[model samples]
Target chain A: MEKKFEIKDLITVGVFSALYSIVMFAVACLGFIPILMVFMPLLCPLVAAIPLMLYFSKIKHFGMITITGTLIGILMFIIGHPYPILIFCIGAGLLTEVVLKMGNYQSIKHCVAASAVFSLWFLGMVIAFFFSFRDAYFASILDGYGQEYVDAMKSYTPTWVFFAMIIMCLVGGTVGGLLGAKVLKKHFRKAGMA
Target chain B: MEIGVCSNKNGAFIKLDPRSKLLLLITISIIMIGARTVEVEGVLRLICAAIPLVLLLSIREYKASFIYLLLLGSALICEKHIAPYTHGICNIVLMMICGLITRFVAGYMMGWYTVKSTSVSEFITAMERMHCPSFISIPMSVMFRYFPTLSEEYKSINDAKRMRELGHPFSQPLTYIEYILVPLMMSTVRIADELSAASLSKGLSAGEKRTHICEVSIRPLDVFAITGTMVMFVLFLVY
Candidate 1:
């Protein structure tokens, strides 16, 4: 139950959470390709561990990830993305920390597994939310976009086409995160931080 | 022949302070968003913005931005000339150009206001900007720092082969993406060792306060630019 992070790490997480809102908002302005949007945070998580590892690599950094995850959750809510993004982040981070406690983080397998778990974390939340509240979720997306592009945005013609896009985003995000982690593993080592 | 990616101009821009650049980027972006659609307005915006952007890119003498420009220009032509079955090419091109002009405005503001002043600082302040922990910036910046260099290395590695670059752009873009991946990853593995050493030498531990040399003050020039952009934006909104 003891927190493993320093004060500044918390501040960093808060700043990044705020950044997510603006970055997503800006991306929304440019395009709506779900594939890219889903994987958008891939790069963030890729190198996200460096700071914690760099500073608190000595102390447990799992709790630090949870706090950052909460910040991201708050930021997403402010940015109008609904609530589960927060829950996914915390649960994923904490679980990854548990895995790390098993001494798995040192190897490439651990990084990849941690990434996959979180990737699934986001996917599970999106899918569950879609099933539980299909109409509301679709309505919110439409509200975010509006009725004008509502029809076009839904590439699938069936009423069920509504939730298909979320699945697509999740798939894209999962792939992107895996790729990001793999790439990150190499890059961090090259940068000499590993 | 590669398109849509920025050049090393960002590295130089990173030298400037961040606050100054943010004001510049936001102001210009507001103006661009405001003036997103008019034809005459679009072309004028392109010119006013393009001049500075070209000068920035010129420092690097990088052809990537020019190629991107060429692709954008060609896309406009295609959207006008080919994509629309009903409208004439001229009309489509005109509409496309008008839409693109807003991005030009946004692009220039990014370069002049934010990038020129605080390009490097963006990486350091990225967490603050993104809601992540500052701990992440070390790896993020390291990745960014090495990315362009790796790209350059990848390009040279490709030149060692024949038919890869020329054949990919005109004949197959996916081929281009495919060919580039291996070298980039290999380069990543090779460089990872060095990055680790560099970070360790610097004692880059998490929760540490990293210094930012890129300081951007909202100067008189910045105020004038913001005011001018806001006025123009208001005019566009009303008109």
Candidate 2:
């Protein structure tokens, strides 16, 4: 039988998108903490994996993950995030769907792997900061805030911080995926999503 | 249904088409993100600064608007001057705070305003007229409906957990997850199933053109809003 998403799958994706956006908004609010800001890229994917994986488990069809990711990207774009971020999110979602499909959407290992890949999409958040360290970026700031302020701001952000954020996202994704799998095994399975 | 944070209250914003509001949001975001010099940023800030004022004026929300304006004005001032004085960590922290205010807060506020003012039927009609594919329009329409229902569900779950004496989220992370996630997931599945059935029965998946009872036409306000924002955006880019 040809497998196309039914109306139910669409609704499921819609509901899941709203839930994901709300959770992400709460995470963004928490990121107001200066220290927590750096960790947010890491923590968001992990926290998000719970709902995400649950959604994934229930709908094991093709294109569902892509739909969710595209909706999220559009929502984020509508909320003023850069267009590039939307592209990045959709790409990550496509990869995640492929990974899950490869594992037949039934294997716990594949689910974890898919979750980890999906988490990497959060890397788009750091792109703005990363660009700010460049000479062109500095020139733009210099035009507005002058040399002294630009210098001060640049000095505050070390080059290593960018790399550190990337590393943290990977670590966070791995841990979050594992945690989501554990949750699925212990709780969601009993709840019938398994 | 309760409109949540985006309640309309018969504001002037509600008079404009949802498409116009969407266009305005896109223009402002592009300008804000692409802004390079302080002059451009300042102009963009000033433009965005008008949004809350308009919202407040339209809604007759004097107190809330006043507080919002006060906070916004102070943050702009701090971003321009106080940011230079603070050195090292303080400087970073202050800049982050200021950036948050200037860059994102406006966009979010505008988004909230649009959500509040535009009814779901109006939004769906606007999307359809824009030639959005059914795959997208169907899900987006459902997504809009999902938010209010989810809020209701969250409240009931909270009450149930409270009755069971489950610890608050702040007290026990693990137990909180166990209590909340399981029930939420289960209910979400059920809700999704029910919602799909209802929508399907309503001919949502018939692959036929759908019409709306919600009359959504571009008014003079929409034309002015879109044109005005576009002209301003072009002007900003020129200099």
Cα RMSD for candidates in order? 10.0, 3.6
Regions more than 4 Å wrong, model 1: A1-159, A168-194, B1-16, B26-133, B136-140, B157-183, B202-216, B226-239
Candidate 1 is graded, for docking, as incorrect
Model 1 chain B scores worst on lDDT over the 10 consecutive residues at: B1-10
Name the top lDDT candidate: 2
What digit string (tens of lDDT, one per residue) describes model 2 on residues A48-162?
7777777778766888888878888888787666666788789988998999899987877788888788876776655655664356556655544545556765674567877
Candidate 2, pairs of clashing residues = B6-B116
Candidate 1 residue-wise lDDT, A87-155, digit = tens: 666676677566555563464445444444443344433442345655655553342223433443344
For the second chain, the TM-scores of the candidates in order are: 0.54, 0.80
Runs with alpha carbons beyond 4 Å of true place in candidate 2: A131-164, B2-14, B33-41, B56-67, B80-83, B148-182
